[model samples]
Target: MRVLLIGEYNRSHFFLKEGLQELGHEVTVIGLNDGFKKVAVDISLDQNYTSGIKKKIKVLLHKLFNIDLHSKSIKKQILKNQSQLKGYDIVQFINESSFLCTPKIECEIFDLIKSWNNKVFLLSCGTDYISIKYAYDKIPKYSLLTPYFEGKGSKNNYQAPLKYLQEDFKKLHKHIYKNIAGVIASDLDYHLPLKNHPKYLGLAPNPVKILPPNPIKEIKGKIIIFHGINLYNYYKKGNDIFEKALEILQKKHKNNISIITVKNIPYNEYIKSFDAAHILLDQVYSYDQGFNALEAMAKGKVVFTGAETEWLSLHNLKEDTVAINAIPDPQQIAKKLEWLILNPDKIIAISNKAQEHVIKNHNYIKSAHKYIDLWNSAN
Candidate 1:
């Protein structure tokens, strides 16, 4: 199969492409480098003018003259590569607005891709119209948008969800839904909301390129705990909760735990810096583990991330079996951290389980087969 995957999120498509290649399928990916994470792609469409003084100038031009130079450049890039995007057995979009282009341009790109290959699937891998709507209407208690709606989160935090609520985004969502063959959820966070949709397929676990467990070293003193923060989406990732919990844990176990917090670092440096850590604190606002948590798990780290009951049921795993389920409550998170710090033996057990879980459930090759099966069945 010749597959084309548009856009990237946390290296999801990169790993998926590796999986597909392993199964004797040809896959091409077109995406941005995804900020400092620098996700790999076959044909990169990353814009050079979206940072520093250039970004400020673009914003000023848009605000003063009502002109979007960024969108124009993105459209031009797409047009330049349109020929290479043709004639795929299947073309999957990473999200509804895959290329980060204007809605009209995205519609044009989707139409063109559909004309070339009718078998197109949309992967519900991140925030989207249906998921945000579901969060607003159904699961407002702890959804990413919940804090924003309740006036607890910054207005900037609501921008993406607000965009989804707009008519233009709604129209684009409808158009893509009507034309795509089906939609596949990458994990329980998306799956729970999309499971009942008319065009819903099934869950395909995020592909993680498993690595051998890093050898555990004897801890002489403080147990190192690492947390990487993306300032822009801090609240949505529940970093605020993690921050407060970390503070409490520090005060309580001042001599036993060494907490490290790094912000906005490059992907290579970020991974390398955390290699010697005993635990990793990942997102808390999700019901399922994301790519970061999975990557940490693959490295045999005891990741404090989403392992909610729904996720446990979906994967048929027991509570706290692999990764720890991080709740939104600071007190709960602190208690969990304190317990882990006190019981070093438990960390080793969970670390082993974490690697085993990734190998069994998120193996890239196995996930590729699932994707192939889904595409075939849809056809």
Candidate 2:
């Protein structure tokens, strides 16, 4: 079978494609190639920074129009590859999300597929349309809103007050979720909310190909914290609170803890830094699991993040596996670290469990097989 994956060839993309091939299928990926070990057909979506005096104007135009101005160009590229697309058995969108921070245009290619009677599977690898809807509706009056999805119910941008806008947004969510085919959720919290619907097929968080167990070295005193920011976008990766916690930690444990901030490293060398750290911190507000947490787990490191009820119920975890629960109070965080310092045995025990969790449930081979099963079923 020939499969076409639409998304940037990142770590997750390569692993998925690799998994598919291991199952004896031919997989070809589209988008900016990161030069990973995957069969890639390079096609630039022409996504770039628009500058000049009109930077604000271009951003405003894109935000207000809610349609990617480059959609036409991307459409042309897709048309040029139409012949190749026909040769494939399935066309799967890895993220399929056109809108990252702005409103995304509905791919004209989906309509083209309608003409060919071809099947397409959209991957739940990007922004949650539902969460975006919730956030959009919660905006105060005179606030800007941009809807990313398409059709009559689609919302991209609007300037409306909180009360009126929320009512409008809530009404739209029920309809869109009901009409969509399915969603793959890595976070159990994300999955459970959509379970009332029939098409919600559960896919685990991004899988990591586990490395051989490295001998545990004494890393209790060494701690590294990761942080990032986007001025135009809301920060999800929990750098702010972590900073606050760090401030409190510094005053208390002055020279005892070492903090490191990692920003925009290349994918291949991304995991290399984890070798030096004992614990990884994840997003604070998000009850969802992200790529960083999963990769750290694969490396047998303890990852700490928020524990939502939905996730606890899904995994039946009394305490987080390899992840210490994130608490707002600096005292709480300090206490956990203190416990780690005093009890290496406990940390080792949890690390063993964490490694087992990733190996058994989130390995690339297992996740890849599940993805192939879904693709076969979808066809």
Candidate 3:
């Protein structure tokens, strides 16, 4: 199979590309570096409108004409690479807005891709029309939208996901579902909302490249807790909740625990920055681990993120055995942190289980085959 993954999400497509290559499939990934994380791609769709005079004009254009220079620049990049993008056996979009364009533009690009590709699929991995509507409707017990529902849905912080609610984006959503051969979710957060759709192909757990478990670093001196925040997603990802919990822990266990916090760093630096940490505080409002959280778990760090009932049932695991289920309460999170601080043995046990969990459920090769099976079935 010659497969083309159309976007990058936390290196999800790159890892999948590696696995497909291992399986003797020719795969190409074409997308941005996923913002500041700078994940690699075979073809770059970078828009150089970020700083200096270009940025000022971008803002001025938007203010005067409601025009997004990003949308225009990305479309031009697609045209420049249109030749390389043709003739794939399978072409999968990483999200509904794969090119991060307006709905009309996305539809145009969809038409272009469909004209050249044999089959097109959609991966409901990031915030999209269906998942956001489902979450805003309160379908899940809790989701990334929980904070938004609680009066924190600021236009500035949540503009990306909120745009899905508009009529233009709604039209784009329908057009995608009508054209794509099938849609597959990367994890349970996305899976639950699309479970009953006729074209839904079930969940393929997010693929993480599983390497030999790094020897569990001995917790020397004080327990290190790492929290990396992206300001744009701080509210949407429930980072505020994590920060509040950390505050309580810092004061309560000041002598026994050391806290490290960072904001909006590159992906390479963000991942490497947590190497010495004993525990990683991931987001508080997900039904499953996001890409960063899963990567942290694969590194054998006890992650404080979603290991909810749905996830536990899916994997048939006990609570707090693999990763701690982080609820949206500071007191509760602090309690969980206190327990881990007092029980270093529990942290080690969970760390070991975390690595094992990723090995069994999220190995890149296994995940790639899962995608291949679904693609074949759809065909």
**Maximum-lDDT candidate:** 3
lDDT of 2 at 123: 63
Model 1 lDDT, full chain set: 0.85
- Lowest-scoring 10 consecutive residues by lDDT in candidate 2? 141-150
- Model 1 residue 128 lDDT? 87
The 0-to-1 C-alpha lDDT of every candidate, in the order given, reads: 0.85, 0.55, 0.89
What tens-digit string does per-residue lDDT give for candidate 3 at 210-290? 878973645668999999898889987788998889889888899999889999998889989998898999888888998
Candidate 3 has a TM-score of 0.97
**Residue 171, model 3: Cα distance from true site in angstroms:** 0.4
Task: Estimate the TM-score of every prediction.
Answer: 0.96, 0.75, 0.97
Residue 203, candidate 1: Cα error in Å is: 0.4
Give the true-structure RMSD of model 1: 1.6
**Cα displacement (Å) at residue 362, model 2:** 0.8
Q: Of models 2 and 3, which has the larger TM-score? A: 3
Tens digit of per-residue lDDT, candidate 2, span 287-359: 5456667777677777676555555665677664556776544566657765764566666676777777778
Model 3's C-alpha root-mean-square deviation from the true structure amounts to: 1.2
**Candidate 3 regions off by >4 Å?**
215-217
Q: Name the weakest run of 10 consecutive residues (lDDT summed) in model 3.
A: 211-220
How much is the lDDT of residue 174 in candidate 3?
95
TM-score of 2: 0.75
**What's the CA error at residue 341 for candidate 2, in Å?**
3.4
Compare the candidates by TM-score and give the number of the best one: 3
